[model samples]
Target: MQKVVLITGGSKGIGKATGQLLSENGFKVYGTSRNPDTISNHPFKLLPLDVTDPNSIARCIDLLKSETSRLDILINNAGAGITGPIEEIPEAEIKKNFETNFFGPVAMIKSVLPLMRENKSGLIINVTSIAGYMGLPFRGVYSASKGALELITEAISMEVKSFGIDVVNFAPGDVATDIAAGRYHSPLKESSAYKATYGKTLELMDTHVDSGKDPMFIANAIYNIITSKSRKVHYKAGEPLQKFSIVLKRLLPDRWYEKMLMNHYKL
Candidate 1:
């Protein structure tokens, strides 16, 4: 029997690539996006879902339960980025970022755990970012959201390990996606306090996003993790430099790491 995989935010970027690749690999894939009509070319079924909305999530899962009865894999790949200085970002925007990036996946996990527990077999992968590990200047909100996700993934992995459920917290570095250029920016009025600093940092971050690694690299990494027998609590995907950076963060002193990031961002 072919395994069934559900991916959130499957309309574009890493989610789209992962859904396509998994479908090609023989999984019965179901992808969710707010705008289901936008994903016409994909082989997998597309359903309307807004992770930030609990009713939307429940309805989507209801459809899945009514139709498929079981799911083999759940990939929480839907997320958004908020770009602005920490101090200058509005409190509401910060809450919204966490709602989408952190709570959204948590809600999905809560909804699916019962089904997976009954079957005693499932793979849950949360698509995080390197930002989870290191704080960036203008992307404080984005980094915080991902950081919270990392902790959530860690805790979930421990909680579900004995139940035959595997949770993989996978972090991919910068990818060439709209997230780089399409990050939601705080209005100037809301960020008038730190415009000079926030503006430059946002510009630099955009540059990095535009030139980042291809989304296929991340798709391949996700495939490998899902197929691996041993569950990994953390997986990092990106350029050689990014891998090195993760290692450095693991081995280096706090002062040294902070200095390195500061130098890299020219802060």
Candidate 2:
């Protein structure tokens, strides 16, 4: 039987590329977007979904169940980006970001587990970020949310292993995507203490994304993970240096690592 795969936020970027690639490789792919009808020329079927809304999630999953009763793979690719000094970011925005980046993925996993468990085998891949492993100056909240998802993936993997459900965290570093445009950026107030530094860091962040690796790179990684029999709990996809930073964090002194990051961000 062809494996049924559902990917959230699949209208563009990494999700789109992964859905397209997997569809080509014989997986029955269903991609979700907030406005599926507005998207055109997508290779796989597009389902309307909004990760931040529980009702939307329920509806999307129900629609999937109606169409394909068995779900072999669930890729929680839907997430939002937020950038601002932690102190300056509004509490509402912070909560909203978590709703999308953190709680959203958790809800997704919970919704799919029963279906996966019933099938006796499934793969759940949460698309996180290399930024999650370390706290970057302006992206603290975003880091925290993704980092939380990373840990959740670890915890849930062990819990579901006995049921033949494999939970994996796939962190990608700075994939070239339109994520920058959608991110909630706290207004850069000229009088705010963090204005000068936050402004520069914002520019740097956008530059990194503009020159980031192709989404196809991450798509290929996901494809490989699906085919592999022996899977690791955590997998990262990115430039060699980006992936190495995670290792360096493990080997470096805390203060030394902080200094390196400060110098890199010119903070």
Top-scoring candidate (lDDT): 2
Query: What tens digits encode model 2's per-residue C-alpha lDDT throughout 1-267?
Result: 999999999999999999999999999999999998988888999999888899998998999999988999999999999999998899999999999999999999999999999999999999999999999899999999999999999999999999999999999999899999999999999899998899999999999999998999889999999999999999998889999999999999999999999988989
CA lDDT scores, all candidates in order: 0.88, 0.95
Worst 10 residues of 2 by lDDT: 35-44
lDDT of 1 at 59: 98
lDDT comparing candidate 2 with the true structure? 0.95
Model 2 RMSD in Å is 0.7
Tens digits of lDDT, candidate 1, 1-267 = 889899998988998899889989989999998989865677678889999999999999999998797999999999998887676678998998899999999999999999999999999999999988888777888988999999988999999989999998999998999985556787655438776666667678888888887888889999999989776699998878877887899999989999998888777
Best by TM-score: 2
- Give the poorly placed runs of model 1, Cα more than 4 Å off: 188-193
TM-scores, all candidates, are: 0.95, 0.99
Model 2 bad stretches (over 4 Å)? none
Q: Model 1: which residue pairs collide?
A: none
